[model samples]
Target: MTRIRLAPDDGKAINLNWRDRFVATDILRDAYVRYEESLNPSAPPFVTLDDGLELGIVHSDVPAIARAISSMLTCSLEDAKNENGGHLPSAVVERVQLEIISPWGVANLWGQTGHRFVLSRSGGGGRSEILATILVGQSRQTIFFLTGRYNNLRHSTVEEEVDFDQPAGDDPDQRWFDLFAFPEIERFKPWGYHHIANFVVAKGHRGERLSRRLLEGIIERYAKDHLDANERPIEHGQHLLCGRGFWQIGDPPWLTRMERLGFYLRWGAESFFIEKPWAPLPAVFDGDRKIGNLEYNRSFGLPERYQGPRPTVASDEHLLERLPEVIALSEDPNAKLQYFQTMFDFC
Candidate 1:
C-alpha cells in the first residue's frame, strides 16, 4: 500500500481557521495528487482529487486513507486551536471532522444516484468523526452467479449457458449453506435487495457504537424515496439482504458484534469446516493463531474443528421480509435486476 505523508512545512504557512477549514481541501488534494503521481508518473496528472473521491474509488480507499485522514484532521484541528489561542472546543473539532467524513459528505461528493458507499454520523446529534462505512447496492445476479444458477459473462467474448454446476469442493457458498442448514437456498432470488460488502472502520475508532450508527444511517437513508440516475423515483430504496464475509469460528465477540448490528450467522460454523482447502482464507485469518481454545489452524495437523477459518454469509431476517414490497413497487424489476448484475459482474 502507498502511504502519503504531507510535509509539516507545507501546512505551516497556511493560516487555518475553525470557520474555514475547507481551505485545506486544496492542500489535501495536492497531497493526494502528489501521492498518485509518485506511483504512476507516465499517466496523466490528476486534475482534481474530487474525481477520485467518487463512490467507486472511495469505498476501496477508505481503509487505506482512514488513518491518514484521521491524522490529518487531528493535526489541522490542533493547528487551528493553536493559532486561535487554544480557544477551539473539542466539540468544534469533532464537528469539523464529522462534517468532512459523514455520509452526507459522501453523498454530496458522489451525487445522490448510482453510488453504493454509505457513511454514518454519531447519534443524539453528538459530533464524532465517521467511525465506519459500508457499501450497499443491488447484487441479485451476484447471488445467482455464486449459486451457479446464472453465469456472469459480461466481460467474456463468447456466449455461454447458465452455470448450473454444483458448488466446487472448497466453495464457501456451499459450506455456508451447509452450516445454516439452509437447504432452500437454490430457490432464493435477491431481487429488490442490496448486498453489503467492505464494511470498514478505523482501528482507532472501533468499539464506539460503529455498527449501530452505520446501520442506522443506511436504514434511515433507504427508508425514503430517492431519484435514480435517470431521475426515476425509487421507492423504499437500498435494502440490504445479505453479505459475504469471513470470521474466525467460535469467536463470540465477533459474532456478538455482528448480531447487534442485525446480522445473524445464517451460514458458517465448525460443523462444516474444511481441511486442506483449495480456497484461500482472508488475510486477517490466514495463519495458525489462537483465540482462547479455538485455534485458527490453517493446516491439516490440527483437529478438523480447528483446521481452518470459515467463510460466512450473514443476513438480516427483518430486511429479507421487506424485499417483497420493494420488489413489488420497483419499476421494471427484471430489467433493474439485470442492470445490477451486469454492473457488478467481473467474471
Candidate 2:
C-alpha cells in the first residue's frame, strides 16, 4: 500500500494512516473542506462547473472571502511539502504563513488591485474543496503595491526583523513613480501590464496541467482591450502590454512550461540572491540531501508577439533554442541589470 501523510493542521492526519484505500482526489477534498471551515465558517458560494468542480473569483474587496482565500493559499503551500518529499524549506513556509496572518498584508497582496482564480468542488456538508488557485493583479496600482511589498518583505527578513504592517504613506501611485523614476517608463505606459503574483495546485492535481488552464483563462479574458465591471473602457486601453511575474531558482521545468505559455525572461532585469537585497532567496532541500537555493527573484514577461487577441503559441523549435538562454540568465543572476528595467521595455 502506498501511504500518504498530510500536514498536522489539515485535520486528516489522524486517520490518513489507515485511509490509504482512498483515492488522491477524495483525500484532498476532505482535507480542503476541513481547512476551509476552520478558516471561514460563512464562505461565499462559487459557480459550479459542468464537471462538478466550481470556478470562482475571490475579490479582495470582500474581506471575509479574501481571508478565506488567503488561508487556502497558505494551506496549499504547506501541502506542497508532501509532494516535494518533505523538502520544502521552513523559511518559505513561514514567510507565507506570516503574509496571510499579517494585518492588511492579505489585502495588499490580493486586495483591491486584483482577484484570485479559484477552482474547487463541493466537498459535501456545504463546503468547497479548493483544487487550484492563481492570484492576478490587473492594474498599475497593483504593480506598485506588489513591488513595494516584496521589497519590504525581503528587507525585513534579511535584517532578521520582520514587520507585517502595511507601511505608512506607501501609496501605490506614489510608489509607482518612486520605483520607476525614469523618462523611458513613460513611453511604455500605454501597454497595460498585469501581474501573476502567486499560484498553486493541490497535491493530487499536479500532473493535470491546471496551471496552463488558469493562464489561458487570464489570456482570453484580459489579453484584449475590454470594458471594466463599470461598463467603461479600461483606462490602460487594450493589448495586455505584458503579463509579468517573478521566477525563483531550482524550478527549471516551471521555466520551460512558462516559456511555452508565451512568458520569457525580461532581458535586463536579472536579480541575484548574493547581490540583490530585494530578491528573497529561501533555502530549498531534496529529502535529506541539500540541493541548491530555491528562489532567485528574477523577473519574466510575456512577449509582445503574444499580446494580441489570439496569441500564437511558441513552437517547440523556438523553445528549444530559447530555453538555454533563459536558463543561463536564471542560473547566473550576477548578470548586469539593464537600463530598460520594466517588462514593457523588453516585451
Candidate 3:
C-alpha cells in the first residue's frame, strides 16, 4: 500500500469534469488546482517494462497541463470570440481553449490508439496523468517506436545552463515538463499523458541520451503499477511501445529507425479518435459500438442514463461525462482494480 507521493499528496486519480474546459479567470483555475491537489496527492502508480523503459503518471500537473495545452494548441483569441456568440468576449478565447483541451477528448484519442485508457496500462500509476494503458504478459510484443528519439547518446553540458522549471506564478514554462533535459526543476512540467499524445523533449535537451532516460522512466512506471504482491513483474502478451509516424504503415525508413528502440510490428492496427482534443465531450461506447451518452450506464460501467442523453461534443450540451465513470470507480474499487490488473492484461 506504499503510494507514489507527488508532493505531500497526489494520486493517479483522473479529473471527472475533464470535459469542462471553460476555466474563466485565474481565480477559478487556481481554486480548481488547489481542490484537485487536496484529493490525497500521493505517488502515482508506476511499473518497469524493460532495461531502458519505465512508466509513471503525472499527479499534480493536470490543471497546469490543461491550461498549457489550450494555449499551446489553440487558435487566436479574436477567432475564438467569433466562434462563441460574442459572450464573454474578453474570455472567449479562454473558453474556446478549454473546449479544445477537454480531458475526455484527450482520453478518447488515447483509447482510439491501442493504448486506450480503459484497455491498457491498468493496475496503477497516477491514473490522472496517464499516457497509455499497456497490458502485460510474457509473449506480448511491447512495441515502442523511436521515431522521436534523438540521434545519439553523446555527452553534453549545454542543457544544464537553462532551467526549464517555472516559478509559482502563472508562468507558462512551469506548466511544461523536462523529461529529457534533466534541468533544475524548481517546478514540474505542464502534465503527464496516457496514450502519450506529446512526449516531446525540449529542443535544448534533444540528445545526449536524455530521451533514453525518459524511456526508462516510462518502463519503470509500467513495472511499478503491474507488479504482484511478490514484487514479480506481470508479463502481458505482446507489449509494444511505438514511435511517432508509426501510423504511416510500410515506411521502410521509419521501420529501420524504430528498430533500435524495440519491436517493429508491420501489421499492427492504429486508431485516430478525430473527436479528441478538438470536439470536447464524453463518449458512450456500447460494447464495440459508440452510442449516445444517454445509453451508457452502470451495467456497462458508463452513465448516459443518470443524466439525459447528449449529442456531439460540439452541440449545445453541458454534459458531465466524468460523473458516471467516477461513481462506478467509487462503487467498486476492488472489482475494477482487479479487472484492470488482469482482465485484459493478456489481450
Candidate 4:
C-alpha cells in the first residue's frame, strides 16, 4: 500500500512523540470507524495507507473528561484550576489528541486541525516550525435556524432532536450532540455564513500565501462535497456548508487574519462530558413504558468495549462564557511534535 512520506527536515522527524501519536492515531481510527458505520451498507474496515499504521486515543475515561471540562467552564478558572489541582484538565491531558505523524513510506500527512499539517526546521540552530494548520472536516446539518434541529438522513435518530439547553447524553445510545448557527452576511463580508472549527499555526510560517492555500485545501477537501446526515447539501446545488472558524482571544494572533479568508465570529456552548452524572438520560421506549439509561452498543464488529464514548460540546451560552479562556490557553500553545514524541508512548 502507498504511504505518506516525510521530509528529512519534516517536523515529524524533528518533533515526534509516542503519546501524542497514539492519541492522534486513536482519533483517526475512531473517525474511520464512525465514517464506515455511516455507510448505507457497512463498509470494510478503515485503515490508512498501510495495515501496520494504527490510529486511536489513549485515555480510558472520555465521558468523565467532558464532565470535568464542563464543570471547569461553568465555574471560574480558579475553580477549574483548584478542582483539577493546577494541572491541565484531565480531559485535555489524557484525551486531547492534538496531532501526530509517522513515516508513511510514500506520502505525507500534514495539517493544523490536529489532523494534518506541515513542519519545517530553521537552517542552523533555529527552532523547528509547523508551517500551517487546518482542521479538515465536520459533518454538517440543515436544521431549523432558531431551534438548532438537524435534518437527519443517515442517522435519523440523532436528527430528530432539537435540544440545545441540556447536556448531550449520559447513556449509551446518545453519545454525542450537535450545534447549529446562522452566520451573518454583509456587503463587506466575503461570505455571509459558514460553520467554523479551531486551528493553530507554527510561528514564522504564519503569514505566507501558501499557508493560506494549505488551510483552504483542508477545508475544501473535507467540508465541501460532503452531505448532511440526511444526505443533502446545506444549500441546493451548491457545496456551501455551515461551520465556525476559531480565533484565539487576546492579541489577535494568526487566526484573526483568517477573517479575510471567509470566516466569521460565531457563538455556541462549550462541549462537556458528564461522567456517571445523576443527570437524566435520553428517553427510550419498551413497547408501553419509558425506559431510562439504556446501554447502547452496536453488534457485529470490533469489540464495542474498545471504543471510547463520545462527549457533548457546550451550549452557546456556556461557550460564550469560556471563549476567552479557550483562546487564552490556545495562545500559550503546547509542546511541538518533537516535545511529545520524546516524552510519550504514541506508537
Candidate 5:
C-alpha cells in the first residue's frame, strides 16, 4: 500500500475523501433540501427533478452462501418450504456496503466529484451544512446531463479525450465526464480542462469570501492528486473555469482575481466564456471584429445565436403574451408532455 503525505497542513488543505458515506434516512434528505434553499433562495420552492435527488442504498455484494441458498430456493419448492415452514432460517450475511449517493443525489450539485470532500472541524459535532460548492468536470457530457435531454447526447462533444478512467469504447454519456474544445479559438486541440460551476454561497455567509476559499481548496486538491512526486517542482497544464454569462453578475467578476494570478480569457461564446493561463480581459469579445467587444460586464446579454422573440412586457411581456396557449397545452396530458420541455414558450 502506498502512503502519501500532504504538504502544508494549514487552513488551505483540501478535504478530499473516497466515497465517504453518512448514515442516510428520510430526515437527512429533508435536511439537505433545507440546507440548499438556505443558501440560495432562488432554488425551486418544491421538489422537482432539479431538487428530487436522494441517496440510494444498494447491497453491492452478497455472500456465496446466500447466493447458493437463493439458488436452492429458486430451484426446489421443497427446499424453500424447509426454510419457510413456520420457521424461516436466517443467517448472518457478509457483504460490502456501497452507498449510491453522488453530488446530484446528496445536494443537487448535478456534476459533483465522485469522491466526497469532508472537512474536519474543531468541535466533535461538525456542521452538516454546504454553504457553497463547485462542480468541475470535463466536456459536453456535463452540459448534456444538465439539459435533461437524452436524444441529443451524441451531438454534445467538443473534445475527444475526457478526464475519466472509463475504459475505451464505453458509452461516453455513462462516463460522467467531458473534454474541452473551442472551435472559435486558434486551431484549438483537445485540451484537458475541467468545468467549474454549480457554485453557491449560503445566504447568511454571503460576504465571507467562502467562494474564494473553496476555489483555492479545489486548486490544492487538484494539484495534490496530479503531483509528480518523483519529479521536482511538479508541473501541470492550464485549464478552463467554464462559466455562463446569463446570470445577473455573470461569470463571477471575482474571476478577475484569478486573471491577476496568471489566468486570462481564452474564448467567449454568446452565453459562455472560458479562462486559460490566468489573464485578464477589460472587455470580452462580441463574436465580431468591426462590432468588437462591447466592454466589460455585459451580464445582461443573451446568446448571440438565440433567435427567440424578445420580451413584450417589461418583465417578460413577450413571453407573457404566449402564456395562454402554453396554459391550454398544459390542460391536456399529451400536449403538456409535448411542450413541457419548451421552457422559453412557457416562460
Candidate 6:
C-alpha cells in the first residue's frame, strides 16, 4: 500500500484526517480498486475481483469509464458489462462542504484550496468517491478533482517567506497562484492572451459521466439563478461564474470521456471547449458605457505556441456582440463579473 496526502491545510500544516483518507498510499490503493470496479459494469455492484481474474461487466458510463476499465482490466469495460447485462447503479452524489477561510484566500488559494468534495459509493464493503472543487473569480471558473489518484491527483507547494497582508483587491489576479490558473492558460490562452472561455476535467471522473453533468449543472445553475428569465445580469457583490475550456493538464491521452461531456476541440491552446449554449455573453463589469460592449482596463495577450484564434483578438468583438444580450438574460451579475474578471487575471 502507498500513502499520499490529498488536501493540505495552509500548505504548511496538513489535515491528518484528510491526508490519511485521501493521501495515504494504502487507502488510495483501496480507493483505486473500487474506482476500477465502478468503471466495469460487468463487475458485480459490490463484488471485488482479484487482479488478472476474469470478470464480467455489469453497468458503467459509456466510453470514459469503459476505457479506464479496459486499460485496467486489459479488457473493455463495455465488453465486460455487455457480457453481464449493461445495467449499473446511478452514481451516488454527495455534496461536500467547502468553506473559504478568508476573502483574499479565496482568490489567492482559489483552485489550489477552495474547492469542495463529493464521493460515490463503490461496491459493497468499499467506497468509491470523487473529490472536486471549483474556483470562480475574475470571470474565470476552474474545477479540479481527484478521482482515483492515477488520472488526476497532484499538488505541490514549497514554504516561502512572503506577505499575506496584501489586500485581496490589490492583487485581484493573485499572480502568486499561477499554477492554479496555469491549466486554463495552457488550454485556452496558450499565446499569452486573455481568454474568457475555459474549463478542464480530470480523466478519472470523465468515465462517470460526472463532467457533463457537472458542467451542465454549472451552466444551468448560472443561467437560472445567475441570469433572470430575461437573461439580464443581476447585481451581486464579488462572486464566481462557471464555463468550459481546457482547464486541466496537457492533452489527456484519453479524450473519449471528454468528448461525451459536450466538449470539442476549438483549435490552438485548448483541446476541449465547452459550447456556450446560451445566447450572448453575460455582462461582467458594473459601471460601463454603452448598451453593448463590456470594457476591460488592461491589454490581454496570447499564450506561447498559440497560432490559433486568440481570445484577446476577439474579446472586444465578442463583448460588443454578447453584452446586451447577456445583461438581458443573466440573473447573477456578480458571478458574471467574476467570470470575466477571472479570465482577465488568468490570462
TM-score of each: 0.33, 0.47, 0.26, 0.27, 0.30, 0.27
Q: On residues 125-213, what C-alpha lDDT tens digit does candidate 6 reach at each position?
A: 44332222223222222223321111112222111222223332355453323211112322222222212211323334445544454
- Residues 30-94, candidate 3: write the lDDT tens digits: 22211122222342233344433334332213444333222323422332242332212334335
Model 2 segments more than 4 A misplaced: 1-49, 61-64, 79-89, 100-104, 144-191, 221-253, 260-262, 275-347
Per-residue CA lDDT of candidate 2, range 60-85, in tens? 33333334445555555564452355
lDDT of each: 0.31, 0.39, 0.27, 0.26, 0.25, 0.26
Candidate 6 lDDT (Cα, 0 to 1): 0.26
Task: Give candidate 5's whole-model lDDT.
Answer: 0.25
Between candidates 5 and 6, the one scoring higher on TM-score is 5
What is the RMSD, in Å, between candidate 4 and the native fold over all Cα?
Answer: 19.9
For residues 1-347, write the lDDT of model 4, one tens digit per residue. 12232344332221222112122222223322222223232432221112122211111112221112122212222212213442223333222221212222101221211222222222223222223333222222211112212221122223234443455456444433322111111111112122222233333334655445544443332333333433542221112223433222211122235445543332321112122234332332333444222121111111221233321322231224434433332222120000000000001
**Candidate 3 ranges beyond 4 A from true positions:** 1-55, 59-61, 68-197, 224-257, 268-347
| lDDT-better candidate, 1 vs 5 | 1
Question: Candidate 2 has what TM-score?
Answer: 0.47
If candidate 6 were superposed on the true structure by all CA atoms, what would the RMSD be? Answer: 20.0
Number of the top lDDT candidate: 2
Q: How much is the lDDT of residue 149 in candidate 6?
A: 14
Which numbered prediction scores highest in TM-score against the true structure? 2
RMSD of each: 18.0, 13.0, 22.7, 19.9, 22.7, 20.0
Model 4's alpha-carbon lDDT is 0.26
> Candidate 1 overall Cα lDDT vs. reference?
0.31
Preferred candidate (TM-score higher): 4 or 5: 5
How high is the lDDT of residue 157 in model 6?
Answer: 14
In the range 1-347, model 1's lDDT, one tens digit per residue, is 24343232222222222222121232222222222313234432222112122111132133223333333334444533423333233555455445433322322322222123323222223322333445443333333122212322221221243333435456646543221111123323323333443355544456766556555444432322222222432222123222222111222223445555555443312122222234322222222331211232222112331224442433332233433332332221111111111011110
Q: Of 1 and 4, which scores higher on lDDT?
A: 1
